[model samples]
Target: MYPERFSNLPEYAFPRLRALLDHHDPGGEVVDMTIGEPKHPFPDWVPTVIADHSEEFGRYPPNDGTPALRGAIRDWVARRFGTTLEADSQIAAVNGTREALYNVGMALFPERKAGQVPLVLIPNPFYQVYMLAALSVAAEPMFVPATRATGYLPDYASLPPEVLNRVTAAYVCSPSNPQGAVASAAYWEELFTLAERHDFRILSDECYSEIYRDTPPPGALEIAARMGADPERVVLFESLSKRSNVPGLRSGFVAAGPRSMARIRQLRAYTGAPIPLPLQRVSERLWAEEDHVIANRALYAEKFAMADDLLGAVPGYASPEGGFFLWLPVPDGESAALRLWQEAGVRVLPGAYLSQTVAGENPGKEYIRVAMVAPKDKTARGLTSLRDCLYR
Candidate 1:
């Protein structure tokens, strides 16, 4: 007699992975590559900053964010995205990208669109929060495929006009989770165009924006500004987790147009747990510095090369362009994952866990997502074993 909105939801990705593999004995030394948690080291100065601001924890944190923290975020956006945003009016510091993402759906999606049940568009193999957020508001969720056929980004433009007309929002992740495929500038232009024509909003999750191989992924806010689209069209989310190796800090920010941002802040006021002031201070400094991020990116680049050296010859294997996950093709995701665990002691998440089975096809059924978040040597060993075990 509880709400059924999320009752039918499948088990979340990691738990499903645990259920699938935990009972097996490892055939070799275990090299876990399942979760995308950053293993890189954060800056040494972070602790000092946190300690200096520790006393502030005695006081209630600002609901939106401290002006100084918001200013730093605003500056980072301008520096990274080349678009200026008013810290006070447009930016809301969030606990993390997950909270920001869910709240976007809660605050922005109306109960009805054109006098009908609204549709909230989500990528098929997407961050779980996006779908959960839609369900939280009772919106009709539409799972669009982000398969390799569509360059691993959802083809929202291909949907029928009737479907488009009812869309209240579409969630897009660039340097997408699982696939690590990035959206190009042209892609952003077309998406913004579609949003404008369809009269819907775009939730652009850019948490992995800072982790790339060569070119930085084009940002939603920057692209919107470039096109002179409505400031409200693209709601942007970013986090310091990957950028600063501070997932534990759980500091991120959401930016949108004045109206939409106001709604987001209002909703957060009641339910959101503000980032501890000390961590916010740590975040301020983290945003202002990029040395650690550059070093971290270089480390990822080195590991990706290791993966390429090991698995480059495997058919259908393309190294990720950004972020830290490898979506390797398999005959059957769960089967491959079990074999990898029991036979090779290499852990990975089956693609089915991250995707919906639509019309009998789970988009991720033939894939296993391996996180390259371990140390370089460990990553090399895991990739080598993965290649030897699966692709050899």
Candidate 2:
């Protein structure tokens, strides 16, 4: 009656959050920190850019991407990462990185590896799409803990050689979603080496790459180029969602080697919804403009400072290098979240929702993920409420 592969999948985090809290009345004004939706303003000119190209909406959009949009992405990559990409051969525009992230597993993961079902390595507390992507393709989604023990990045290289030999793809998120941990250059090198040794590909998710504190995090593409690694070894997915606060715009791209791009484009041609012409036009203008992104990053930087000032004294508080989440430790994630909602009306996500229980241990069991996407005053209020309610 149904695809059994997805039967055991836990409820998506947002629905699970509603089920956990919807019945209870908030004790105070509700300050939702559960979702990572950005409350900041996108560039003012984006609408104008879209309006100017609105006529193109009548035409079926280019499936892979418009040349102008691809060129804009290619140029931006060159400027931002110091790696030149062939717009036509190495890039394919996706509605958002989420879709690309999912489809990529389908397009790239082999039917079998080493005469066994392929393995898709995923960070334990990951973007939910990564797991679904693996499962949809019948690859065994292997969860490796990306906990404090491993510096908040998955230690893929630590896996046994037998397991590594079966890996067809490994997903790595820089400035990770829940943890906000950035992969170091050395970390990238080590992972890249492992991929090479094991003959697996790297699906590098850098959607949150633009939102960070201090130095810009090193990108996998640049690191791969530096190491003289196979171009096909690394495929990067980034979006304007977090970078420009345009999640609704659904604009992003997947960049990889020519051969990989061919497979991705082929899969996308059959089933992908191309970015609308007007939106692609807007994306082109947005990619060329950095003033907006810089301003957006500055706003996140302020929040990072606020988080550190408030929570740094807590025993396990470690300020994230990038991204908009505060992965704060508590005695128990679900209990702390319920307490925050019931006592303080601050809605935050239970970290356990984002991770799986493997062999009776869930890495996220002891923490809650708080999003800093709200405006400063509201974010401060939420953090103060949660801190006083739980950490105090």
Candidate 1 structure quality by residue, lDDT tens digits, 124-168: 898898888989899989999999899999999999999999999
Candidate No. with top lDDT: 2
lDDT of 1 at 204: 93
Q: After superposition on all CA atoms, how large is the RMSD of candidate 1?
A: 0.8
Q: After superposition, which runs of candidate 1 have C-alpha atoms over 4 Å from their true positions? A: none
**Model 2 TM-score, all chains together:** 0.99
Clashing pairs in 2: 95-250
